[model samples]
Target chain A: MTLRRIFSFLFLLNILSCKTDSEILPSISKEDIQIKWPDYFPQPEYNFENNSLTKEGFYLGKKLFYDPILSKDSTISCGSCHQSFVAFAHADHKLSHGINNLQGIRNAPGLYNLIWQKSFFWDGGARHIELQPIAPIINPVEMGETIDHVVYKLRRNNAYKSLFNKAFMSDSITSQLLLKALAQFMGALISTNSKYDRYIQNPKMNPFTDDEKDGLALFENKCSSCHPAPLFTDGFFRNNGLDSTFIDSGRYRITNLPSDWGKFKVPSLRNVEVTYPYMHNGRFETLEQVLEHYNNGVLQSVTLDPLLRNGIALNNTEKRKIITFLKTLTDRDFIQDKRFSE
Target chain B: MQRQHTLIFIILFIFFKMKSILKVSLITLIVIIGFSSCKKDRKIDVNTEDPSIDKPDNQEKFGTVSIVFSSKAGNSDLELDSVKYTNAHGDSLTISKFKYYLSNFKLIKDDGTVYKQEESYHLINRSNGKTYTVELENVPVGTYNSLNYLLGVDSARNTSGAQTGALDPALNMFWSWNQGYIFLLFEGTSPASQSFNQALSFHIGGFTLPYNCIRSISPSFGSQNVLVTEGHNSTIFVNTDVLKMFESPHLIKFSQVSESLGGAIGSSISDNAANMFSIASIQN
Candidate 1:
């Protein structure tokens, strides 16, 4: 080759190499990270802007979520309550089973599409997603570990040190970084591939059965006011008139308002099939019981929802049809996804 | 024909050897250039250096100002969780918890120039007696006549998202439900209190309008200024009287009014908190 051509060739090679290097850079590339959700879904409340999501952070958080080292006794992990199967909800257990078989007061809710949730917990105590893990970690019955102790333990471990180094670019393992890592993992759980999601995405591709269609119509007319579509929750606290008097003040404990008595967050109905024993206290076992309560068993109270004042007028056939529609919300892919499992 | 073939082969072999050498030299040059360029692009990586006990301040002519908080009731030092003192209302009291947030620290110069510490939020607890003395580093070298501080967590910090260090909600100073800091927490048992065992609990904090409880306090040093110079260590002794909390604008009798959860009583406590502290001594 000529001297001029050789110079040109080297110049071209340098440009090509630089381009390739930039592509493989370790910085969190949002383009590479795939957060799967149907187009019909609204913008996530957690945009992952403050704590940007990275593959390394997600993996580290996954490990932390499953690892019992986060607990005081080194026996209970977050996954002990929020398992991947049954849509991250502790199935069969009405109330959450904590460390040393200690029973928690409330049912452990399913953990998917959490990025959309404005406030965490049934009572809506934790305002930020980053602050949510701290509550469980120090709850005495749950993980039973202090934030400092968890950081201290993680700092000493070689595996966690390397993971932290990769995730946060620091092996110091600060509480902020630890919480952020957990948030990344929890926020990545997007459950939008159920039969309902498919039907919503393309009305013809995944056609609903006649019973499911009738149930969906009934659900839209009756339940859609509180348990809305797309995300399956309006994200508002309401007194569904489950009881005349509440033992657990629910949202009232957080708000300290008389009107907020017996008010609990309208939980997302997605994956509600496997995540049974519903409600803030897990009072009801089956969807039939839940339907039966709404149909005729709703008690009158001071803070009872105006929508449920007259009670949902549903016959036995209509209730069965509604139950069938609720089953379509069960996302099998989400529960079996190996990405979240131990 | 064999001689011609051999000559051609020799020339070809020499040319191939020279090309290989050139390729090796070019590759070496590229590697050197690549490394040098990579090094040139500043990598803002983690501080891999050992954690320092004292953070090295890069500012010029700055010194540390340590403020010592001493809780007092009348002549004797107030002991926590033990009934020892009487309030202004002649009520025998035992304070169990006397923790409050102090923030927006400012050092007022003789000329009225203020040196405000950025993000200066400190949780002072009587339970943790050792932490009562808050050491403020990197204070500018100057003669400060008065030191001003807010007795509560500011509305800005309260509304902001999750914070770390002293402001972390995990520290137990933050109110998870109200979404604000419990700025002044004074829990004790008084003989005049109506509750069981004469328990007088005051969780005074609210950052919203109509109940905003943030109080700014500029302690008077009385013409004697705190001198801050390079390498100079100084201690500003501040005396805090819990008795003052019950007195001043709002005469809160333990028997009549004890708990100030979040209304008018909470707002008035901030006013009382302002008068609760007095500058005792400033040693340079």
Candidate 2:
């Protein structure tokens, strides 16, 4: 009887020890979270290696992107300006509208194909994709909230706690983890499968109109040097003869080089149809105005782009064809995708 | 019959003895494993520094070296917000905030042997008492004469992605718009200022060439040698003068330049900031 009792006690102890390590929720597999893009496109500048692109992390990031809790007054979110329908660019607004209805200095650029971007902002201030979101979050005219407070708020909320635990498998919610989650969502925004892409893949299946065909030829001749195909941007800073003197000082603010004055990053023209009110300061409201400026309104500046020194000579018909071509570059499938919506 | 009974009793005794031995061994194994797991967790937490550089053959022979910074304004100790101190430019200022980053520490011995501390990024804030000292652990036993450290974060960390701990972006020492760290932030109110409410803010930062503000500081021990023997902790106290920032190579009068967010003015301030520290004393 004594021997039997000892064996039973030992079995009980084993059971209790096993129960000490509680089971965590099973994480989604890595294979399910692949970033899908076209093969012709260049390699992504950011590879989600440090912060693994799990489905849970991506969803947590998508929730944070739409939630207005990031702002000081709980009013503004990243999605407040970067609407999905317009390819994530602020629709109709010249300047980004901030908390208390204040206006920002620069236009809120669309967030798409972000993994390809080496640098961010018109001045190319933010160097890394993971570090880009902090610019607008703490900007006094933007969200007007500190990152410390944002982390504190997320930690206190039980819903976010569970979401963070599910995503990172850690109880501690740090600013680093928060930024990584944001990076996952932003980097996954691959703007492929546009009409232009389909036509390039199989010209017979997706045919371009006569106007678009002519526009493509014109774009190849005039704009393709800066705005290349597949990605639509060469990612170089250029003074496109927008101004004689810079009020914003553009890339010079970051480099502190006088030669870089009045120079802004060449924006991607993937969804040029919807991402209107163009230019660094959103000076031109329409595509015609932008083309007109490039055609004849090219202002003389000390740091003017040598390509646009004399401006690209284009007639009214050629400008119309270019606009038609720009419309085909819009990815309808991307804007309507349910996975990116709140 | 008596022989049979004695044989059965012997078999039972051996069986009971073997069971007890198994139980004791199992418990011992679990205890050993438990202790080792606890030690592994501690190693992960404290020993995040690179192993190849300062990994001693025997950890028992290593000692700790603590570098404590003492902030001063001219002849007097720096008292933020209350005491009004006059600078070399004759501008009386009441400092509200003063902070900067120090990284990449190297301890040079009398024999010219250099001990490089890995992952050595420290932010020194005058307002926070906790940040005033940085304790480097597992330092090899040596007799050190002098030490070298950077006044600002290196360019590699400036371009790298989000960081944690002392280099965390939540610290407000970072410039989000410019995508670099504000190496030294000195803000206060002075009567000689032209800005709103007599405010004087100088946020010095720039990691790029020609305007790089990452200043390397090697303080002289002045005939003093820091002896780092086994298990003994050595303390090095250094004086950081705030008034030296306003004078030195360039005398920054508050009337002319009250605010320097960044760029050329910030670089000039960082140049003057290079002469702000000197070794005070050593405690072995």
lDDT of 1 by residue, B1-284 (tens): 23433543454355445665675575456546644443433232322353562455565578889899888775567788766777777777888889889998888888988877877988888887733877777777889898999999888677455577888665777664445688999998877888877888888887766678899898889978889999888899999887899888877778898777765778887888789898888999
- For residues B1-284, write the lDDT of model 2, one tens digit per residue: 23433543464455456766675665455445444444554455445586764566754478899999988887567889999999898998999999999999989988998888889998989898522887888788989998999989999898778889999999999899989889999999999999999999999988886788888999889999889998889999888998888897888999999998778888888888888888888999
Q: What is the lDDT of residue B134 in candidate 1?
A: 71
RMSD of each: 7.9, 7.8
Docking tier of model 1: it is incorrect
lDDT of 1 by residue, A223-286 (tens): 9999898888999999998889889899776655688898999999999999988998888999
Q: Which window of ten consecutive residues has the lowest lDDT sum in model 2 chain A?
A: A18-27
lDDT, candidate 1, equals 0.81
Candidate 1 deviant stretches above 4 angstroms: A1-26, A29-33, B1-37, B43-71, B74-83, B106-116, B127-149, B155-162, B174-181, B187-239, B248-250, B255-271, B278-284
Deviating ranges (above 4 Å) for candidate 2: A1-32, B1-56
Q: Relative to the unseen true structure, what is the C-alpha lDDT of residue B130 in candidate 2, on a scale of 0 to 100?
A: 24
Clash pairs of candidate 2? none
lDDT of 2 by residue, A1-342 (tens): 565465445444544443342222244455645688878998888988678788989989999999988999999999999999888989988899889998999998888999999999999999999999999999999999999999999999999999998888889999988998899889888889899999999999889999999999999999999999889999999999988987999999888899999999999999889998899888889999999999999999999999999999999999999999999999998888788866
Model 1 chain A poorest ten-residue lDDT run: A3-12
